[model samples]
Target: MPSPRPSLTLTLLQARETAMRFFRPQLNLHDLTEQQWRVIRILRQQGELENHQLARLACILKPSMSGVLARLQRDGLVGRRRMLEDQRRVLVSLTEQGEQCFASMSLEMEKNYQRIQQQMGEEKLATLLELLRELRGVKP
Candidate 1:
């Protein structure tokens, strides 16, 4: 009989945790959780996005996104506004402080990324990223 295969989902999660090991210190130093860092990163790149859109991109659930946004808002790192055209729709964006925070952390994050690329050569890192993107595009 053939040996059992390892669980793909668990393996992917473990890989993610391994990758996060390099960046978690920076996040913790800024008093940010992984979820908050994701939200901030997305907002920085995309400018302003609707709450649902932000949640989806950040891989956060609707229910949990509320708390995450609440904390960010409370900390004055992000701001939310209701759409005038669609009252139900909420928009989220990074505030000045959020931008500053991102700027402050950019150097450390870049260094960590460089360290990773150095450890796992640029070609290998590129291939891994491409494979992950392709895997994400796979249809169930």
Candidate 2:
């Protein structure tokens, strides 16, 4: 008889899908895609960053970041300005609308986090975080 393969990959995939279910509804309320929301959240936490920096912070590729910036600019949620020292370099920042949207969405995101934490409890949550960090080769 063949032994069962490890289920870690399946568990990770399922967890990701479940988390998206929680995120999708909140994102839809703000008319934001998951990638867009990720960008906004990264900006909120990291402050202003250039396009390439933002892409790195958001874990997205440069081409996708370009599209996200275009959409954000078109929606008046983000603004860009040439760097004073280097005209070729562009700095990106959130507009008033973007800040306001992030503030609202942040609350929603917090609530989701809290709900999960409560469901899992502190011990399990800590273990989960430790496991995830180890998986990513990050020391806890």
Judging by lDDT against the true structure, name the best candidate: 1
Pairs of residues at least 3 apart in sequence or in different chains that clash in candidate 2: none
Report lDDT (CA) for all predictions. 0.97, 0.87
Q: Per-residue lDDT for 1-140 in model 2, tens only?
A: 99998798899999988878877889999999888888888877787899889988787899988999999889988889999999988988888999999988888888888888898898998999898978988456
Error of 2 at 115 (Å): 1.7
- Runs with alpha carbons beyond 4 Å of true place in candidate 1: none
Residue-wise lDDT of candidate 1 within 36-122, one digit each (tens)?
999999999999999999999999999999999999999999999999999999999999999999999999999999999999999
Question: Root-mean-square deviation of each candidate, in angstroms?
Answer: 0.8, 2.7
Candidate number of the best TM-score: 1
In model 2, which runs have C-alpha deviations exceeding 4 angstroms? 1-10, 138-140
C-alpha TM-scores of all predictions: 0.97, 0.85
Candidate 1 local accuracy as lDDT?
0.97
